[model samples]
Target: MSGVDFEQVMQAALAADAGVAGIVSRRIFPLSAPKGAPLPFITYQRVSGAPEAVLDGDAPCERISIQIDAWAKTYGEAKRLAKAVRGVMAGAEFAAELDEDRDLSDEEARVCRVSMDFIVWA
Candidate 1:
């Protein structure tokens, strides 16, 4: 898939996750060029209703970590964008991490990192 395609997939997947009311905010970081560097990170915090499993004690508060290195063209750019995006999510109720080692296919190279955070209940 192309970088744009990868980004769309990631966004769609996150938006469709269970218990997500809506995206409170979103940020994109443009990274420097270089492969294998950390990509921009995206975090989404829940807006309402606790995870059913968490309430039932069947599972802890749902913490999801999704890494999308497919949209970056270089390692430096990915890392830079990841950090920049994470900065955007600072003080958010949710947390996320960007994996630096992963690289998307050539077609999936882009220049920005996307991060979001959602709070289930706050």
Candidate 2:
């Protein structure tokens, strides 16, 4: 997928899950970069031999994985945000995984690797 598409999905996920206003604060890497970077890279692919109703996937029953780095003002706050995000995402029929990492600086910012599979229902 394109970088713009990735950003939109990330922002939507953050807003739907955490109720937070999200912007593409950083454009550190490409949307489809495979390696030569840190973990939690956002990736997308079309599924083959799938039905026609699927959005990103080739088949209607298929889905694509989305990954993003999430940050918050504090670790506790980040965790809370991640939990809220997951809760809301579940209702949207998206499976999400939130991985949190502590920020070394005093800025109280932490990164969360959020992933979900996008599926278009009938």
Candidate 3:
């Protein structure tokens, strides 16, 4: 991951995919979305990562854990967004290989959320 723009690549991948962009429209963000932003947006962050170790040193590739949160006003929309993310990133080996996911709500905000975790060799 050294010297790589992880967030930029991730953002591009999401934004370029029609399945994701049709809903979010490049609203994908790193770490968090802006305050009071629009609904059905997305936020992603690196939960954990490690260099691919070799017998003597680090390798170019890495093992990374990425978490993506899809937020919307309806539970259905959140789930749809997760599916799109999983589809678009399947080749990237990130969002596709979902190890865990949960449907949630923000009581105060009254919004639906689907949080998913995926681990992959990036």
Candidate 4:
């Protein structure tokens, strides 16, 4: 419990979500998606994290700042996928919130991406 697998926990949370799975299927990946894998996929990157301190010791689950990107062939799809991600985070039992969001253009990959920053305790 001390060395929590935040990435695995997050990926499971997203993959098990019906709404998220409908659009991306099982294409959720860590750090980055595979090169030329497919469209309408998801990628996540860890920005930073810190263990919560208590009087006796640190909490098992740490506070993590993560960036999640929804990539698609179209801007609309990316936005929609991003919306689903936001919804899941909002409805989750754990502590999670959207800190920021942005629309990115991947000229090299010819894809539209909706990037989101979230702070989560996991």
Off by over 4 Å in 4: 1-4
TM-scores of the candidates are: 0.31, 0.39, 0.90, 0.89
Global CA lDDT computed for model 2: 0.39
Off by over 4 Å in 2: 1-18, 21-58, 93-122
lDDT of each: 0.36, 0.39, 0.84, 0.89
Q: Which residue pairs show collisions in model 3?
A: none
Per-residue alpha-carbon lDDT of model 3 for 5-94, expressed as tens digits? 666677788889898999999788888899988989999998998989999999877777889999999999999999998877786534
The digit string of per-residue lDDT tens for model 1 on 2-80 reads 2333334444444344322122123322232244544333333322243336454755344343333223445555555
Model 1 alpha-carbon miss at residue 96, Å: 2.9
Tell me the tens digit of each residue's lDDT in model 2 across 27-114: 2233454345433223333222233564675652333343333333444554554455445444653343333323222433233443
RMSD, candidate 2, Å: 8.7
Q: What is the lDDT of candidate 4?
A: 0.89
lDDT of 4 by residue, 1-122 (tens): 23657777778888999999999999999988778788899999999999899999987768989999999999999999999999887777665899999999989878999999999887
